[model samples]
Target: MGKNDFLTPKAIANRIKAKGLQKLRWYCQMCQKQCRDENGFKCHCMSESHQRQMEVFGQNPNRIIDGYSEEFEQNFLELMKRSHRFSRVAATVVYNEFINDRHHVHMNSTQWATLTEFVKYLGRTGKCKVEETPKGWFITYIDRDSETLFKERQKNKRIKADLAEEEKQEREIRKQIERAEQLLPPEQNRESEVEDSAARELKLESGVKVGFALGNSAKLASKEKTEAAKLVFEEPESDRGMKRKADGGGSKSALEELMREEEKKKEKINRKDYWLCEGIVVKVMSKALAEKGYYKQKGVVRKVIEKYVGEIEMLDSKHVLRIDQQELETVIPQIGSLVRIVNGAYRGSNARLLAVDTDKFCAKVQIEKGVYDGRVLKAVEYEDICKIVQ
Candidate 1:
C-alpha cells in the first residue's frame, strides 16, 4: 500500500501501536499517568484537555522544559536524600533507583550531560558531598530537611545526656558505698590503735569501768628498749674497714681496669671524623686509603676533598681531614637561594630563600605576587622542601 493508503483502519492502528511506549516504558510526572497500550495514549493525546495542555507548552517551550528539569532534579534529590543520605553510593545506583518511577523525568532533559557532571554540580551547589577517586565518583546526599536533622540531633543529645546522668549516678552510688564501708566497725578497728585507745579512755571517763593490763604494757616497753640498745651496739667500727678491704681485692681491681679499657674502646668506636649534614653524605678518607690493606697509602683524594671543605693532614699512616667549623655554615643555602615548597597547605609556591634560622628551626622564604612582592613563609622540616633550584 501507498503512504496515504496506510492511513486506513488496520495500518493506522498498527503504526500507532508501534510508535507508542510499552507498558513498562510509560511515565507520568505530574498527574503521574502511565498508559499500558497505544490506543489509550492516542485517545488521551486527541482529547480536548491534552490539546489545551499542548497549546500551553507550545506557547513557551523553554519554560516547560525548565519546569520538567526542575521537577526531575527535585524528585531525584528527594529519593537520594531519603534513601542514601550520608552514605557514599555509586551514581548509577541512585540513577537506577530514580528511573524505577514511571513518569520520572529523564536525565537527558536535564542540564547535566552525565552523572559525574550532576554529582559535581551537587557538590558545587552544596546539595551533596561528591568525591572523585580512581575507581569512580562517589556521592553522599546532603539532607537539608530541618525537622528530620533536628530530630536526629535531639536524639543524639538525649542519649548523651542519659549516659552522663547514668555515669554520675554510678559515681554517686560508688561514693555512698565507699562511705558506708569506711563507717563499718571492722574497718574502723583496723584504722589505728590510738583511735581505739582514745575511744576506750572516753568510755572510761564516762563512768564505764574498763580494766587495763599494765603487766603486758610494761613487757612491750622493755622489749622495745632492749631491741633499740642491740641495734646501737651491734655495728662495730673495725669490721667496716676490714669489709672494705675484702671487697677491694686483686680480681676486683683487675675487673675495674678492664671496665675502664672497655669504656675507652666504646669511646673510640663512637668517635667519627666525618659527619653527615642535611642532604649531604659523609665519606671517610680512611675508607679511600684502605684500598691496599696494610700498605698504608698516604695522599688525600683531591676529587673527594673538593666536595668538602677541610684541611687534609697525613698523620701516622692515616690521612686525617680536619673539617673547618666555617664549612658547616658555608655548605648551607644562603639567602636568595631558589627553592620550591613541596608539602603542606601552601604547596607549589616557589620562592627565594630569605634566611635560615637554625635556632628557630625554620627557613624564611619570600614569594613574589604580581607587583606587591610581600608574601613570606616559614618552612620547618625536610618534608617541606622540594629541591634547591640552584
Candidate 2:
C-alpha cells in the first residue's frame, strides 16, 4: 500500500505494534536489529548483511556481550538516578518503566539474566539501599556526588567538635567549683551567721545605728551593700529629705551618711548616661582612669550589641553596659531593694545575683544559707524573689 494509504487507523496501529519490542528470540545483539516475527528474523539472518555481522561476532562473541553489558548498566543507572533519585521504589516497577522506551538496552543482550540479578549487583556495589519485602525488592538511590559527600562530612565534624568543646568546658568548670568547695572550712560555710555577727560588732563599736538590729536583717543589709558595690555606679539626684536630716544636725556621722548617699546616686546616673549611640563620642572609662588620669580619649560608638549582657564598641574597644531596663533607667523596684526567695523548697532564703534569665523570668542566685548554703547558683523564679540585688 502507498504511504498515504498506510496512514489509516488499522495500519497505524499495526506499525506502532511492530515498532514495540517483540519476542527476545527475534532480536539479534550482533546485528543490532530487531525483527517483528520469526519469519522475518529467519529471513534477515540469511541475508548477506546479517551473515557479515554474524562472522564479526563469531571472531569476538564475548567482547560484543561485554560492550552490551556495560552499555545496559550505564543506561539503567542513568535512568534510575535521573527519574528516581530520592524515591524508594520496587525493582520490578523500575524495570517496567525502563522498558517503556522502544530502543532501550534489552536484558537478554546484557550479562545479567534478569532484573533481579541486576538489582542485587547494584546493592552489592553500594549504589542503592536494597531491602526485600514479600512483594518484591525495593531500591533507594544513594547519591554519589563527591562535593555533596564532602560537605556533609564537614558539617558532621563541626557539630561533633562543638559538642566536645562544650563538654570539656563544663568539666573544667565543675572541677574548679569542687576544688573551691573543698578548700573552705566547714565553719566558714555558715555565711548568714558570719555576716550578722561580724557586721553587728563593727556597727556597735563604730557607734553606728542602722534601721534594723535583727541578725537576719543585718545579714541582708550587708549583702545588699556588697551587691551595690559590684553594680555599675550611677549617681542619683541628691535627696531633699537627706539634706533636711543633715540640716537638723542629725549627727557628724549622719552628715557623712548623707554625702555617701548623694555620691551613690550620682554614680548610678552617670553610668546610665553612657548608653551607646553611633557617631556619639565616648570617653575611656577604665582602670586607666586612676593611673593615667582621665583624658578626653574620645571615640565614636561603632555598634551596640546584646549578649547575655549588653555591650558597646567605641573605636576598637568593647565595654559591658547595663542591659536591664530598670537598671538602665534607674527605676526603683516596687518589691523593695532586698533579694529574698519567698517560695519553693528554699523559701525565706537570700542570695546574691549572678545573672538574670529575663526570658525565663528567673534569677541565678548564690545561696547564702539553708541546705544549699555555699552553693553559687540556684535558679529561682523572678516572682518568688523580692528583687535582684545586682
Candidate 3:
C-alpha cells in the first residue's frame, strides 16, 4: 500500500538485515546504527544524523565512552546471571550467547579491549570466580542475593541463642565453683596446706637424687620405740566438732563429683541426635561410598531431607548425593566461624572459633549458646567441632 509499509520489500529487507549479529566494527555506538559493510559504514559517517552524534560524542568523549562501558558491563552480567547461573562456563561461550541479542552493547565501545580482560576484572572484584585453564577462561557466579543474606541473618540469630545458653552454663559452673570454694574455707585450706607441706614438700635442689640407707634392725627398733612413746589419741586445741568438720566426708571433693555428675547430665540432655542443618559443609564418611571413591570427600548441604538426611552437593565434583547425616561429618571453616561441638563436654553446643593450633590439630573456641556462652575451651580437637554453613 505505502512505499515504506511493513509489507514493502524495502522494509522486509531492512528487518532481515537486522535479524542477527553483524560485524561489531561496523556498528556505531553513538549513532546506535549497524552498517552491513565498510562502504555503508563510511557513507553513514558522512550523513547528517551521524555527524550530529559525532559532534555530541566529541564534546565529552570520555564521559560517553564511560556511560557505554557501564551499560555494557551491566547488560553482560545480567545475561550471565540469567543464563549461566550456578554453572562454570567459558568466557567466549557466554560472550557468543550475548551477541545473539543483535542490540547488545559492543565490546569495542567498552573500556575493556578484550573479553579476557573483562573476565579478569570480574575475578578481581569477586563478582565471579574465574579460572584460566588450557581450554581458556571460565567463570562461576557468586551468589550474594537477599536470600543468602537472609540465611546469614538466621545463622546469626542461632549464634545469639547459643551465646545466651553458654552464658547461663558459665554462670552455673561459676556458682558451683563458688559453692565448692565456700565449703573449703581459708582457715581449713591453710591447715591442710601446712599438713601437706610437712608430709610432701621437699626443699631439694633440681636433679638431686637423695637416697636413704637401710640401717641394722637394732637401730630401727630403737627409732620405733621413741616414736611409740610420743603416740597420743587426744584431740588438738580445737573442739571435737571442729575436728569432725576438718575431715567432713570429703566435702570439697564431693562437691567436685557433684559438678562432674551435673555436667554429664547436661551432656546427655543437650546433645542432640540431629546436627544436620541446611547450607553447611560436611564430609562423606559412609564406607559404602568408599568403593565409588567419595569417602572422606567434602560437600555442601543444599537441603536437609529429614532430621538425619541431607541432599549434599559435592565440592570437587559438583555431584548431588543423598546421604544420611550420620555418614557425614561437619566441616570446620576458618577462625571466627561459628562451629558446632560434635563431641566433648560441650557436645551439641555452638561456639565461635577463636584460634587454631595446626601443629596440635586442635582449635580454641568459646561456647556461644545456652549456659556456656563466653566460656572458652582452649584445646578442642579438630574432630570435635564442625563449621556452621551460614
Q: Of the pair 1 and 3, which is ahead by lDDT?
A: 3
TM-score sort, best first: 3, 2, 1
Residue 186, model 3: lDDT of: 68
Q: What local lDDT score does residue 103 receive in model 2, on the 0 to 100 scale?
A: 80
57 Cα displacement, candidate 1 (Å): 1.0
Instruction: Report lDDT (CA) for all predictions.
Output: 0.50, 0.55, 0.70
Clashing pairs for predicted structure model 1, backbone only: 27-103, 28-103
Which numbered prediction scores highest in TM-score against the true structure?
Answer: 3
The numbered model that scores best in lDDT is 3
Instruction: Estimate the overall C-alpha local distance difference test score of candidate 1.
Output: 0.50
RMSD of each: 29.2, 25.3, 17.8
TM-scores of all candidate predictions against the true structure: 0.31, 0.42, 0.46
lDDT of 3 by residue, 1-390 (tens): 999899999999999987877888899988879989999999999999999988988899999889988998888888888998889999999999988886788989989989888886675455676766789988887666789879967976975586567557757756754454446556755664544322111112221111111233344445543232221111223434553576673233343355467566655544565666666689998665788889999998888753555788888999998776656886779888898887656776788887899999899887764654555677888877887767
Candidate 3 Cα deviation (angstroms), residue 328: 29
Candidate scoring better on TM-score of 1 and 2: 2
Which ranking of candidates, highest lDDT first? 3, 2, 1
- Predicted structure 2, TM vs. truth: 0.42
> In terms of lDDT, which candidate is stronger, 2 or 3?
3
